[model samples]
Target: MPALPRPAAGPGSRYTARASTTRPRPARHTDVAALSRHLTTRDLWLARMLHEHRVLTTHQVASLAYTSLRSAQRRLRTLHQHAVLDSFRPLTQTGSAPEHYTLGPAGAAVLAAHAGCDLADLGWRPSHTGRIAYSPSLGHDLGVNELLARLAARSRTTPEAGLPVWLSERSCARRWGDIVRPDAYAHWRDGDQTLPFFLEYDTGSQPLSRVEAKLAGYAAFTTATSTRPALLVHTRTASRDQALRRRLAAPARELSLNIATSSADFTTSSPWGPWWSPLGPGDTRRTTLTSLAARWTPLGSAADLEPTDADTALTLPVPPLPPTPDAGT
Candidate 1:
């Protein structure tokens, strides 16, 4: 075997050898920076992208991180090894082979802990795909699911209600025709008149322009019906301020709408139920005092509220009760 040359030593290297002459060699300590150096900016960006999208493939994360797919894959493995991420799975896209990558629970927890950090703040922008849903069925179901449930319940209650509960109805336009599906429609005979009601339930975060368009549809349908009422019930996860309340309630009231909006009355049971009735706005006060008293009453103490002769003397005259299910607006 050929002899190999040894490394030349410098003055600094001699200090370690002369142990008594110099300070005893300190014990090797962990390099904190080295421990975290594997986590590059690309890895962080990938994690943030997954957090925003709620799901991502290796290719997708790579594209966001501005790195090669393989580099992105290696980074994910490192992250998994460091307990920063859990694991990944295969996801198939049309016209492409299966791609495997996803943020594990650990990854999600980290991302969520710092969710307020925005890519826009970091000078990054994602392409606007304008994709409605991953699947056509999903979009259809999301748009029509709750409406269908209400209709199904109505059908079970009144099988002969003559409600047209179609999934897809086509509409014609000059340039582009669209499939328009009104969520539910029911018709009933009222004093020799066939009355119809069109129902729509919107539950997603939607644009104001889209909201106006839906309102326009409801207006048109209501105008076309024999003697029907158009009902729109929109539930949202976000808070609706009083300004929004006034804006939403104004049109319905002006147009003689039976519209109702859920307000911030979280104390009442069925917090999201019909809190206000636009049709009977005056009747709102009827139950206010009674509701408060009922809430304060102890359980199993219905007998405790027996009115005395003095209580009858102090009673104020209440308005006559309206027959039928009044909105008590």
Candidate 2:
């Protein structure tokens, strides 16, 4: 039998009726049902991370959410397809970069449900996620999240280490914008002790002078808050580190700011080790996290940050603090 050739121009044809190339997002009720049935505890964690951090890459998702890249990819793809997640791939000079995931419509609904709030309360707009790709600070934003992620990863591996309290740029801006918009705010605690710090992360894409400009704000904030937190400066290159140190010298002395500079390092034992160079005169050896308070007396007490629970808390890997801080590679 000859193939049917009389189906052209049919008004009621099912297959040829301007076949929709776009996949429509699921309805709210459909998404909620799917969430209840298909979502896992880890999936919820991943959504929280995306919601808090704004974005995360495949490798970052793997490190923070899954035990392996294959698992992360498989799960992420499924989530992306099912409208439980959304992603965008940025173009790089070398090629394209890893797709960055943010909260999707369904994911926002899921988060809101989990938090027992309305979708609007999640503070999520699809436009926000879409606009991130075009933002000038996209690299800087991802870099900030990456730094925190690395710290969170370290905390998970090192039992003695304590997870830090992370506040996003928006949160920092909301909390203390009068002082200076910090890249982020973090408080690291070991047992009962907590030492909060202001984070100034540079991706090496901006000029060193810009970094110098931000220090004055931190200095002023420290002066006003009566809280001298370690202003940890994480940069991409050693040159940037040195330049930053030199630039910070005046502020450190004049404002009595406890500043430390270190090259952005994600390797094991790098951040907690003596990679931090205190930005001041006399015995400028690299210092550890706990030693920062001692080196800079204004940064409160060192005894508070030491893990003194004397329990197995230091013997096992624990989840990062403040619930969910974002991460990206």
Candidate 3:
């Protein structure tokens, strides 16, 4: 049989068989339920993009889906046709023609469903999530942007006029020791001069040291070469406002930093009564300065005047002190 004539290999047959024999195992951890979650063909594509990329622009989706721009437009139009994704058409910066698409409520839900998870579980928290700071990825000066809008609105009717604002984060660890980049900031410039205002919405338990350092930076920044004001805005009830105002109000006469408290807008009444503090009994009470002013009168008739020493001093409910010879005199 001539050694049975070694079997000649078929053309590409051995290679093809070898390649076909080793099938890849399906992804084990994948929830089979996800396949059923997609709504339509368009929803399937959108879900794929969101799952793969975490986010996707309409242009990117068009490219990924290998569809025409018009098709992509129709896709976005359809998915959001009933405000499905909670789609919102926000204006672009100034005159920019291209508008950016962001995930809205419905889109978020669809994407989350596809991923078999909630966004909040993926590190996005609800309500006031701490404070906003420089997100290196976002790149834009979100803090400065917020500040500009506020300052523009605040001084929209003020006579002092608008000033060009300059804003920068500390950008270094050493500077972080003495400064904090609050959620937002504002800068005003009037002719070869500029002033910076930092906004802090303290909904967290920030260390006192950090707060003081921020105020110090603001004061230092405002002092040289220009006379201007640095304002810190807070919820009216925020203890931060109280602590900061007390420090800035006394002895630091040169500081341009001012803490304003009100019941409107972001403001709320203080949680504690006018007199409450852990720093000691009197610490939380109205300042002695305010107490003195509130207690004093024009030395009018004795009947018109209540007891000064007794009234001025915040007393715990107890016995009244005996009048002293010189005190009465």
Candidate 4:
């Protein structure tokens, strides 16, 4: 996890430009209805994904949706052309950064129409792409997406495994913000075993104490809602992971919160593999994400997963993988 490059100062810096000149964006007046005709089911799904996740890099998009990088690039470029998606490349010290994408105006329109809601209700504006492009939390957002994308990709080849449900931070906030603000919420399935957990993507920027304090909120959330989902804290380094496990162990146990900690070093190859270590007394050995459920047999089913009065079909979490017919594209 290399440090993200800081945005250069001045009006003319690369950070100021939202899109590259090589692939120009469509006009602001692009008709959403006409563009909708050309969008495949997969394209519509991608638009929904971008709307939910805030942002994803080209590589991450490929991992989640396409069979190859070349094919992903091709379709993504076309989406950009139709203003179904918007993109930006960050200023990097060495090589160029991969194109990062967000929902475009047409995309929002399509999504709103699908949900049978007004465009304003979707909470999107012309400045959405630019705002996310320059957001301070951009790296954290991308890291979260990257980890989930890897798990989703693994499910493509492994028949027994799948990431059936993935809720972005915004969705998590909507459902449980009053209790605990998790980075994301997901349901990881390996055969008959399903592990529902809330993710905390730590960049190792905040103080360890502040991070430890988050456990109290999770405890309150569990007590208030009568749901005990596992808390997974993923840090940037092995050292940071060790520090977190040490700090969170006692508090997590006292609160009866099933917590686990993992770092980027061990998860790079296979995030679903044996990288997660449970925070408790004995057998500090790491375990796979799916196998984690067995370690904590008392861990019950996830609560608050059902749709509330506020949810519409369009706003609900979509399956991480696209429909089988269009996945290869």
Candidate 5:
């Protein structure tokens, strides 16, 4: 027989596959029944979080779930050993990079079983971890997760503050891709105040004009859905923050979009603090996220977060924070 032509090289060629550095999958078998024997409620929740967010770092997972980094690392390593979670450490220019985690095959099985659905319903593939490990948007995804994880972590100490609903980019896109695709959508509750906002985690990679243009979609989404959630544009640097504020001010006002801008520097202390600067002439003072609800009283009538009939049953929203642990686990 004539020699078969070498497999055509394209997107899935060996050359492209070499980019990922994820640890090898465990050779040992992992099944849902076996997992049930030892997996705790927190482990299941972490699997759901990894499934929803795509990826999270060791530090981010620690902030969101564990009491300390040591505990988080220990449990995470256990999960990794059992193949409930897969991890990869990326090469860094200086110090080492934290191990970034994604849902493994066993995790997807557990999630699907818990949700009363098939593996296909989970929308995960064998290539999921490798894809995320080598994705170009890995840094951006981590940044978004870091900010939200901080908000979730804050609830641990501040009993009055909580993030009830946090939807990842995929979830947001499913709901509003036709109108506007926000980086994430969340409901921030502080005492008696609740603010629902769409986040735009800017990394200073795109032109300011392109960033400003996103307001048009938000404006349309508001009109189409008759809901007016706040739009928060968080930039990597203060200079980018100011530039975005200036560039977006006119259009935001023109569209009557409730928009705000903040930088990483200001948010390092506490994102829930007075770090957000609204767009408008002479509106220079930063304000808290809860206060923004007061600033735009109309948000009271804009609480339309409930899933609609059009949403796929598989894509229902998940609580940002895991369920509170029982008295003893």
Candidate 6:
């Protein structure tokens, strides 16, 4: 890391100028020449995450990537000044919320160079990004990312259970076309069992009928294929989970599609724990990610999956909510 110049000493230091008498010269920010050297591996990783997820709250980024809010803020401010990151805070009923961050030109350029690809292929388009601040799907988008972040955090601690693969919606589109748009696709690892599944996250803004309509497509897609990964539905509340489970069981059995349902508000428990239940009212026994193969028998015969040990990491600990950020423009 390059050494940062020290601040001026006392009230009348050389680095400081009395605003009334003299205009302070903005100390030269990191120039384009030093950008690649200035960015650490962690910095690149942060930019990659921002690119993949699109929008993330300061609190979310800080919690996931930094040890403290102060450090995250310091780096973010520097990155912003260098045009490496762009941010905007949304207006809310209670004043405003934590500012969100996205990849800026400098950061995107660096990623493009590292990947040996053009900015377009790297998913950088400021024109497209500018319109996301007020998009109606913003809440739902962040909600899906929140679930993935939690899973990522859990994977770090519970090696026995890992998220080996996670594909964004855009990537899923390229892989599966418009047949069925899952919010994300993942391969979850539990001991020896590997479960490939699709995630459908609901933000409580849609009607139950609309959600059921999506399941109909999933059922059709599964029925048309020989090997089908399980479908996991995560809702905002337990009540919604129960309702969706009942609705899903009919199609899953009728079409023989494997499915599991859970609520994102399982506040006190780790999502990796037995937070999921197979789609049936009669069998309400909680199941783990790895055990889904066993719980939903169809998933096993779909491939060479074998019965693995129980997900020993039951009750994954949910971290405290990310620290709030200061007011931003």
Query: Clash totals for all models, in order?
Result: 1, 0, 7, 0, 0, 1
- Flag the better candidate by lDDT, 1 or 6: 6
In candidate 3, what are the lDDT values of residues 113-209, reduced to their tens digit? 5455665633333221111221232223332323233333233234243423322232112122243445444444333334344455443255645
Question: What tens-digit string does per-residue lDDT give for candidate 2 at 13-85?
Answer: 1221111123233344344755556666566666767776788888777765555676567567656655667
For model 1, how does the per-residue alpha-carbon lDDT over 1-329 read when each residue is reduced to its tens digit?
Answer: 11111114322222222211222222432232343343444444445433333334454444333235555555554454443433323234654432333344344444434444333432222221112223333333333432332332332334443223222211111101232244433332222233333334444455544644455555544455323343434344325423334456656555554443333232123221234333234443212212322322221210112345533211211111111221111
* Cα error, candidate 5, residue 274 (Å): 1.7
Candidate 3 vs. true structure, TM-score: 0.29
TM-score of 1: 0.31
The sequence of per-residue lDDT tens digits that candidate 4 reaches over residues 169-281 is 99888878888899999878898888888999999999999998999999998788777788889999999999988888889889888888899999986999999999886
Q: Looking at candidate 2, what is the lDDT of residue 203?
A: 75
Candidate 1 vs candidate 5: which has greater lDDT? 5
Q: Could you tell me which residue pairs clash in candidate 4?
A: none
Clashes of 1: 1
User: Residue 26 in candidate 1 has what lDDT?
Assistant: 22
TM-score order, best first, reads 4, 5, 2, 6, 1, 3
Candidate 3's displacement at residue 315, Å, is: 57
In candidate 2, where is summed lDDT lowest over 10 consecutive residues? 11-20
lDDT of candidate 5 at residue 306, scale 0 to 100: 73
Task: Score residue 174 of candidate 4 by CA lDDT.
Answer: 80
Q: Give the alpha-carbon lDDT of every model.
A: 0.34, 0.64, 0.34, 0.81, 0.78, 0.64
Query: In model 3, where do residues sit more than 4 Å from their true spots?
Result: 1-182, 187-196, 224-227, 236-240, 251-329
Candidate 2: count the clashes. Answer: 0
Off by over 4 Å in 2: 1-29, 114-118, 189-195, 204-210, 265-269, 297-329
lDDT of 6 by residue, 88-132 (tens): 676689855776777877778877777666778776786645667
Prediction 2 global C-alpha lDDT = 0.64
